[model samples]
Target: RTSIPINSVDQAIGAIRTKIIFGGLVISVLAAVLGLFVSRRIARPIGQIRTWAESIARGQFQYRPSITASEEIEALSVSLSRMAEELRERIDTVIRQRNEIEAVLSSMVEGVVALDMEERLISMNQAACRMLGIRMSDMQGRSIQELVRSTMLHQFVNDTLSSRKPTEMDIPLSSDGEVIVNCHGTLLRDAGGRQIGAVVVFNDVTRLRRLENIRREFVANVSHELKTPITAIKGFVETLRDGAVKNPKDADRFLTIIDKHVARLEAIVEDLLRLSRIEQGAEQGEIERIDSRISEILRTAVQVCHVRADAKQIGIEISCPEETRAWVDPPLLEQAMVNLLDNAINYSEEGKKVRIRVTQEEGGMVISVHDQGCGIEKKHLSRLFERFYRVDKARSRQLGGTGLGLAIAKHIVQAHAGRLTVESIPGRGSIFSIHLPTNPPRNGSASHGDPLQPS
Candidate 1:
């Protein structure tokens, strides 16, 4: 080994130190770049996943996150996307079911009300709001007592909830007891069969009740009317059998009285049969109709009642255009006009005037009979068209009136798809109008006329 110079050795050691330091520096730089790249690779996917999660929270299920750097991260993103889709499907199902339930509730005709366990109104349908005379928007979440003023309805709801069983009640809503509601209440339950609340359904039964009452009254009236004539006939027959037959004068007087009653009975039976036939024909769509001059029909009716008018000294006048025509059953319409004219003549005082007027009105033709007589009271107008309904029973009987004339007239008008209306003032006068529709409705679908009124 050659003796090395100190300068040379120092240079060599310095170079070695420089080389180590340079290598260490290069290693540190390369390690830092690798760490930075790895950090960015992990952070990018994480950031994208965080953004996707935020979008999902905002209900943006359609947003997808990009994560191709790491297989695990890509797998995680796919799983999260599936989860979001499932959540969306479940939410859609819930919304669909809710809409279906709402539709069912809205279309119901009967009034329906739902209450919570606390007796607060949860929901009410349109029919219920109308029946209770309340607004649905303002009634929600209110107590039942605050919404409905009826004690019976309140009790019914309470009973339904407390009993947890079905219950029924007939509640009267109107002050005059005209509006009656049949309520059926049942417990509301969840899918798990847990009692949640109560639901009440209301059906209007006022018309049904009125019809039932009319049926009962009709039976009673028929019985009384028939009994009166039969009892008289029986008594006269017994009198003839006992001793009156031996004396011709007494027998003749009794026989004449019996004949009068018999004649009245026959008239009643004939009128009843006519009404039955008219009703049957109207219901079966069998009443024959033809285009006829209404003036001719009115003239015929006047001719039929002229004798009665002469006896009462009631002057009759007809105001109609000869060109006026309508689709009508001639014989039936003539009978209706005859009944009205006879009534006008009978009810008029001596020298009173009975006027018949015909005119074209909107949607129909009107034939009105105006009588200058003791007009009907307002209280009796509504029932005047009912069979055997008389304002003055004793006076009607004394006049030899059968009490079936107005009823027959009404049926005939209805058969022609017409309405019978009356307006009267107690002391002024009365007008009975037959409103015949220009175009008749289908058979058996005749519109019931509005209730009679007093002017």
Candidate 2:
């Protein structure tokens, strides 16, 4: 703070100012360089974290970054990584649950369909697609009406959306055919207990309904058949007791008529029992099988039916090689053959020729009986094997036929794991064929071979 000459003092102040300014400039330049280096060091890790966050945003949660910055930065990266891992695990769990649900729905036999609030198809299983005769790819997002075209199904969907309780009905579909499906409808709900959509389950009950109808018809037919003979016998017996007994000739004739009815009743009962036994054997796999010469079995069956054939003056001509053999239940097969021959004899006119032909086919052996008889109409052929089903009821009864011979034969062939089919042209002739597999299951083990051709 010493003052010299005025000019020198001013000069000294100016030199001090210049030096202070130079020193301040040097310090600022050095500080700026150091700050830049520090900023680069910090920004390197921050930029890497930013890149990692971007990848995570793009759904790359499994991606990792090598971040070796300050402890605070490292802790932050670790927390972010943990959060990403949790998010990834949650997403994987959701995907897995969705797949599991899809699998369960696909394997179900009953048809299942899911609809959104707007009645558009959200999901449909394979069975549902098959039942509805629609493709899943074509049906998705389509309205129920557009897919099904059934009034009852649409009503059911509306009911399902409005009501929480499940409802069921039989819906008839005319897509492929007259298919009857039993449908069960219920509302689908979300986790928050809100109504989200509806689900309908379909079960094909057409075969069950047909079987029920057949059972009812069978019961009715059996009752009618039994009542006819019973009523006839009762009426003849009452007539004999009233006045016919006073005359030996009338009494004898009434007794003979009663005897015929009794015999008819016995035949019906016996045939029914035989049918029941054959059905049980077929169901329980109790039909014992053995290798036997088909010609020998055929010959035996011919002998059993020769008496009836002789009465009708029908000549049965057999055409089977002696060496041809098959795995068959000999006694059962022989009985089946005898029944077929007897039926042919009963239906054939006097002096008619019946041909029994046996040949090895692509699938297996075939034993067919060609009869020059009154061929059945196409309508009656389908139910020819049904018990008590007769093509000509009056003629069948007049010929002392039990109306169960063909049914018994069919059951016998079925027990052998075979199919019995008939081909006939009206006013021409009839051919009844028994299609048997050559390599049938032996000793409780199935043996693969050519399958039966379509009939």
Candidate 3:
């Protein structure tokens, strides 16, 4: 090895140390820059995910996190987005089901009410509010006894709640008079099979009860009427069979009496059949109506009653305009008019005039029979048109009155959309009138005339 100068050797060693120090500085700067870029790449996605999670916690499910830096980050973002969508869908489904249940309850016709186990009113339908005469605002959280004044209804709710089973009852509410309601109650339970509430439904049955009472009364009256005439006929027949018919005069008298009873029975049966047919026709909407002159109907009825009037020495004086007309079933109108004329002739004193008057007034025509007879009492006038009803039963029987003629006449007039009314004073006379519309309204139409006023 060749020996070099010592100063030159020292300068070479310093130059190598400077170069190593420069290289170290450059490497340190590069490493610091790489660390900052990697940290930013990781923290940017993490920051975005945190923001999305906070928004979701605040019920903003529409927010979605996005991460494109790494596959793991992207997977996390997709999963979070799917979770938000699923949660929103489930919430939406629950809300829709709740609305559907509310809608179904609102549209019900029968009164419906729901109460919690604490006896607080949870919900009520429109019909329930109407039936109870209360508002929803007034009924909320109120106890059953507090809202409903009826003791029977309160007891029914209590019974349902205690039994945890369905119960039914008929309750009478007396506001104006008596209104009957059919109520049914059932326990409401949750998914855990735990009783949570009760639901009550109410249906109005007032008209049904009234109809039942009327039906019962009609049956009783009909039985009594039929028995009376049959008993009389049987007694007369028994008298004849017991040898009272041995003498010609006695036999003739008994035969005449029996014939009269038979005629009365025939009249009753005929009137009953006619009344039934009229009611059936009215109910089935099968009445055939036509425009007929009122004068002609009155004249025809007068002719039919001519022989009876002659026997009673009662003159039927008709006063009707020739041009007056009514919308009616012609045969039915004639029958009703004849019944009125016969009643007038039978009730009037001999030598008295039975005036048959027809007048057109106020969108309708009125045909009346005025008789000078023992007029009806005020109490009897209300029920004069009822079947088998009579003010003087003995006098009606003696005059061969079946007690159904007025009832038949009333029904016939009603079927024609007309009214049969009576005006009377006990000592003076009675006026029986039939009011018929000139242009009767069609069935189910609302623009109809007012009902007849009581006289």
Reference-based TM-score of each model: 0.86, 0.88, 0.70
Per model, state how many residue pairs clash. Answer: 0, 0, 0
lDDT of each: 0.88, 0.89, 0.84
Instruction: Give the alpha carbon lDDT tens digit for every residue of 1-455 in model 3.
Output: 98999999999999999999999999999988998999999999989988998898788986775578798988888888888788889888998998897788778778998998877788898888888888888987788778778888888888888985689988987655478889999998889989998999999888898778767877887787778878977887898899987878988987897787778778788989999999999988888776566777778888889999999899889898776766677788899988998898888889999998888779888888899988888988877988888889888878878888999999999998889999998867899989888885587422322233333
lDDT of 1 by residue, 1-455 (tens): 86989999999999999999999999999999999999998999989999999998998888886578778888888898889999899988999999998888788878999999999988888888888888978886799899778888888889999995699989998777889999999999999999999999999998998889888988888777788888999999999999889999999999999999899899999999999999999888888776677888999999999998988888889999877777788899999999998888878898999999998999889999999878999999999999988899998888898889999999999998889999998776789999997664555343333232332
User: Could you tell me the lDDT of residue 96 within candidate 3?
Assistant: 100
Per-residue lDDT value at 8 in model 1 = 97
**How does candidate 1 score on lDDT?**
0.88
Best-to-worst ranking by TM-score: 2, 1, 3
Model 2, 154-232: lDDT tens per residue? 9989998888799999888776546899999999989998989999999999989878888998899889889999999
Candidate 2 accuracy as lDDT = 0.89
| Model 2 TM-score, 2 decimals | 0.88
State in Å the error of residue 299, model 3.
Answer: 2.2
Clashing pairs in 1: none
Candidate 1 lowest-lDDT run of ten: 446-455
Give the clash total for candidate 3. Answer: 0
